[model samples]
Target: MARPRTQLLSRDIILDAALELINTQHDFTILGIGRHLGVNPSSLYHHLSGGRDEIINALRERFYKNIDLASLQPGHSPWQSRIESWVRSYREAVAQYPAAIPILIGRIVDDVPTLAIYETLAAILVEAGVPGSQHVGIIAMLDALVFGSAIDAGSPEPLWNTTEDRQPHLHQAVASSSTPDRVASGLAMGIEASVAYIERLAVGPSDGAN
Candidate 1:
């Protein structure tokens, strides 16, 4: 005999199922998600307004909740390392569901908690003497690296492989033997460049004017 459905579907349940579907299928369509949960596609609208923004927001909220925000803990070394650590943590969390990238970038919330984190980091950069004008840009750079790296990590190996004769530079860069190490090196380079740029911007007397 088939087991009867006893658990009533709630918004949270729907969202949870949707996230699972996304993880398993790497597809974020509402209809696909519905099939995964054994519910009618239209039913999702009742709990999760059949809109990209709504789905994206729900996913982003879940992503943030799962992250160890404490990764931003105070450290004795330079603020750049702390910033890199935060970016690394963010990348690791989001990499779990690469299909969630578009959702993340869609609705960037700047509410109290989010603002608090941003302001805290901005202050650290300022204390490190980073220029006020470049704060937002610095954060944006970190965001790009995190998101871009997540996307690249999710991509298939064949997409990275290239014909050596046709594309020497590309082939050499994507050489399989050291691909993983190269990705790490690239991420570190991205973070370092952003941090170094901000540190340089901190040089003049107008550093903390904001």
Candidate 2:
């Protein structure tokens, strides 16, 4: 008789299953992943020693890797340009997996690659002459923009639903806007605003000017 073929389980396989669950259900469990993969839940332990936490970190790494890190590298371009490229790339990447955003953000990022991305951002800010005291806050603000934009990108159009009779000015503003890619346009605007703020910080209090 021929020997029975065993189901193959690896980090990729497990992570893929978990991601699928997260995409569909916005959450995942070890047993659920096992069921999705047709393996016993305990069988997953053989592969993921840290189990669910490991899977979450692995998924985080997978998505973070989608970012175009090369654009953020120290370059001859102005710091503003580099920062713009980094955020644009980040929005593009995270927007691809909007469903995973909550789960990914809910966990503290201990992954090496993910941490390295932050490290790179810190280095960029340092090079730009941004105050060390403000680095964490600045980075946090960028993250908020990126994550919020990622979720908004997946939302249906006509973001606002104000009636002209109730709020004529607000309605007119929404109606007058004719951007082809609203999400991208908004993201670009936000990134530009953020970089402008950072530029001001790097320049300091302008020698006593209010």
Candidate 1, after superposition: displacement of residue 118 in Å?
3.4
Worst 10 residues of 2 by lDDT: 201-210
For all predicted structures, in order, the TM-scores are 0.73, 0.88
State candidate 1's TM-score: 0.73
lDDT of 1 by residue, 95-176 (tens): 8788767756666664444455566677667667766787788877777898898887876755655788999988886674
List ranges where model 1 is wrong by over 4 Å.
Answer: 1-5, 20-55, 71-77, 110-117, 173-180, 204-210
TM-score of 2: 0.88
State the displacement of the C-alpha of residue 107, model 2, in Å, after optimal TM-score superposition.
1.1
lDDT of each: 0.70, 0.83
> lDDT, candidate 1, residue 96?
79
Q: Pick the candidate with the highest TM-score.
A: 2
